[model samples]
Target: MASMLEFRTPGWNPYAVKYSPYYDSRIAVATAANYGIVGNGRVFCLGLGPQGIQVEKTFDTNDAQYDLAWSEINENQLLVACGDGSIKLYDMNVNDFPIMNFHEHKREAFSVAWSPVTKDTFASSSWDGTVKIWSPARKDSIQTLPVGNCTYSTAYCPSNPSLISAVSTDSHLRLFDLRTPASAQYHLTAKIPVHVPSPAPLPQGPSPPAVPGEILTHDWNKYNHTVIATGGVDRVIRTFDIRNPSGGPASVMMGHEYAVRRLAWSPHASDILVSASYDMTVRLWTDGSTMPAQQASPVKAGIQLGIMNRHTEFATGVDWCLFGVGGWVATVGWDERVLLWDANAMLRGQA
Candidate 1:
């Protein structure tokens, strides 16, 4: 038995982790105290002391601030999503309030993300059931992607700047292509209920148990944008080749004992996969399509490391990050702590 995680550095002892072009570590995170700085995802938890959750010194997303996004082009600029249907732009260097407040959504924005390929392009989805593309240069969104139900979360396609996908509270997954003349209107590419049939135990143990057919949420792979990996309420991680909408899953990865909340690929290692679930464990899987490892044992497949991943709360989001030098995985949760899982060390036992 070997450990999958090891400490590269203990920079910040904070609650959330985010990277922006403006900061030194390119990391800006939220804590119970002041916003902390990092040179490269490396943080130093600098705070006076702990205070009550209601204390003035305790850092919380007050009415003034809600969800936030780091600008891709302008490292110093931060976009904060407010409860008042407004997105505020903040400049860290001056410590001034928002420079621009874009109030477009009728309801509170649930999540905000920047396009990796498109400069000045960002997307936002709201509890109002719509996803809109925005550019600070213009007050109005060039395209408003319509969603069938209230979108829970969204991620822009990695390979294509215009392709985006989102999940709705109705438990349906929608994919959008921002190429049509009427790009504002989104088409329902695929929709399925997030449920799976109970499996009958096989002689071998129990064939890979039956699971839900529809995806819960999806993330565009950092290495290959055309490839999308989704985790669901069914407890399965399904990867799709969005390049060919007709193409089926490259493979279905099963490991988690409960509904999965997050899935991400290693930034440096394209073949490695990490997932988090409500079961309170994060499993690491290696792509085994063409190796002896692929057939070592069918009953035990895909997963290589079933780490007892500890978290303050259930894990919700996971991202690959490079802090100072090596690769690390950042996780967010209901508990509000942004944990750094040393991904490089997960494969230390590899022969």
Candidate 2:
């Protein structure tokens, strides 16, 4: 039987959920009132116990919180990206207020990511069309890489602190190498078109021309350092190898009936991933790169494994727990509900 737990935020809608890198029982959620249109935001530090999920701490913000990231070095500290272009660092041990505020972006800060390798620096992407690199000890950003469009997600390469990637409304995935000289175009080394024409034409008629769409979320594969997955307004998920991005997507997974809101590559498996969508469901998928011949298909390079449809509103955020047996997952949505479940149990034939 599958085990599941839930917690409701009452009036606030959660935009993102991140599991604590240090504690299995702890997680943080970024939320906004009135579905992030125009209201105050709240960040919740929640604890899981025998009694269930409980709020351990809460920080209210003057603007909507779109995304957050847990500090890799300090378990008690986390960062929140706000609608007002401010990024705030909160210390769980503190009472009622953020410990540090880093305001630089001229537009809404859409995403925040802590460097898994450096453990000291973090990055934030914004509607300002740039991704800024910063340190918790600094008052201003260390570097800003311009995306020229609304950059929705940004993450540092887990294996290389010098490498960072970001996706934007321009339907492009850009890779920046901080090791490159500043004169070399802001350290931007590669720009891969996220939407590419399908290799094969449909049987009945010609395949529709590929159209660019806004990319909302992306995540680097933990085990596969050169691989990254992207999802967006097109309702399709695509994976590409940073080394050979011109060769086109290594795999494509299509199933979501609405735009894909967020995606997370599993920490424990190279081929497994989970996605949350506006369709109000969280779906599991395998990239088919590691599947056996009979299990993989040419038309569908990646296949959906299962679906969890308990959310009553747009399923915006989903994340995998870094602890335990590795299948425990946490998801949050516009329904103001957070659901924790064992994903391994939902797999088609897994025992």
Say which candidate scores most in lDDT: 2
Q: Please name the candidate that would achieve the greatest TM-score relative to the true structure.
A: 2
Estimate, for each residue in 139-215, the C-alpha lDDT of model 1 and write its tens digit.
Answer: 77877777756665677776678777887666555677676556334544544333332222222334444543434
TM-score, every prediction: 0.72, 0.95
Q: Looking at candidate 2, what is the lDDT of residue 171?
A: 95
Cα RMSDs of all predictions? 7.4, 2.4
Report the backbone clash tally of model 2: 0
TM-score of 2: 0.95
Candidate 1: segments with Cα more than 4 A from true spot: 1-16, 21-24, 30-67, 82-85, 183-216, 287-301, 304-308, 322-326, 349-351
Give stretches of model 2 more than 4 Å off.
200-209, 293-300, 348-351
lDDT scores of the candidates, listed in order: 0.56, 0.91
